[model samples]
Target: MSAEGSRAAQIKPFVRQALVCPVDKGPLLDAGDELYNPRLRVAYRIDADGIAVMLADEARKVDEAEHQRLTA
Candidate 1:
C-alpha cells in the first residue's frame, strides 16, 4: 500500500469508530488527509502526522461541488 494509505489506515478501527462529528455526532468518513462529514458539509483536516484535527472552529466548510466529490 502507498505511504498515505498506510498512514490513513493507522487509526485503529476501535479508535476510528469513536471519532464522530462535533456538530451532530454523526460518523466521520476517514479520508486519507481529512475526515469528511457529509451531513454537515464540512471536513476536519488530518495533519501530516495522521492526527485528525477535530476542532469545530477549524472545520473547513465544503462547497456543494466539493461536497459531492467527498460523498461520492
Candidate 2:
C-alpha cells in the first residue's frame, strides 16, 4: 500500500455494511483489521486504506480455536 492509501485504519461504516464474503456472499464481521466469515472460517485482510481484500484465493483459513474466538 502506498503511504497515501494508509491514511485510514478503519473501514467506513457504510462500506462495512455493504461488504460480503466474495465466496459465500454472506455477511462479514468486522474483526478489527480483518473481515471474518465465521460460517466459512475464513478471514480477509483489511488494506491500509480500510478496504477489504475480498479475494477468495487470498483469504486466510481460520483454525478451529481461532474460529471459535472470531465467532465469540
Expressed as tens digits, the lDDT of each residue in 1-71 for candidate 1 is 55347544677778778889988999987655788899988889878787778899999998999987767
lDDT of 1 at 1: 51
What overall lDDT goes with each candidate model?
Answer: 0.81, 0.78
Backbone clash pairs in model 2 (N, Cα, C under 3 Å; residues 3+ apart or in different chains), count: 0
Clashes of each: 0, 0
Query: Clashes in model 2: which pairs?
Result: none
lDDT of 2 by residue, 1-72 (tens): 442333223566677678899998999876767888999999899776666788999999999999888788
Q: Which stretches of candidate 1 lie over 4 Å from their true place?
A: 1-7
The residue pairs found clashing in candidate 1 are none
Those runs of model 2 whose alpha carbons end farther than 4 Å from true positions after fitting are 1-9
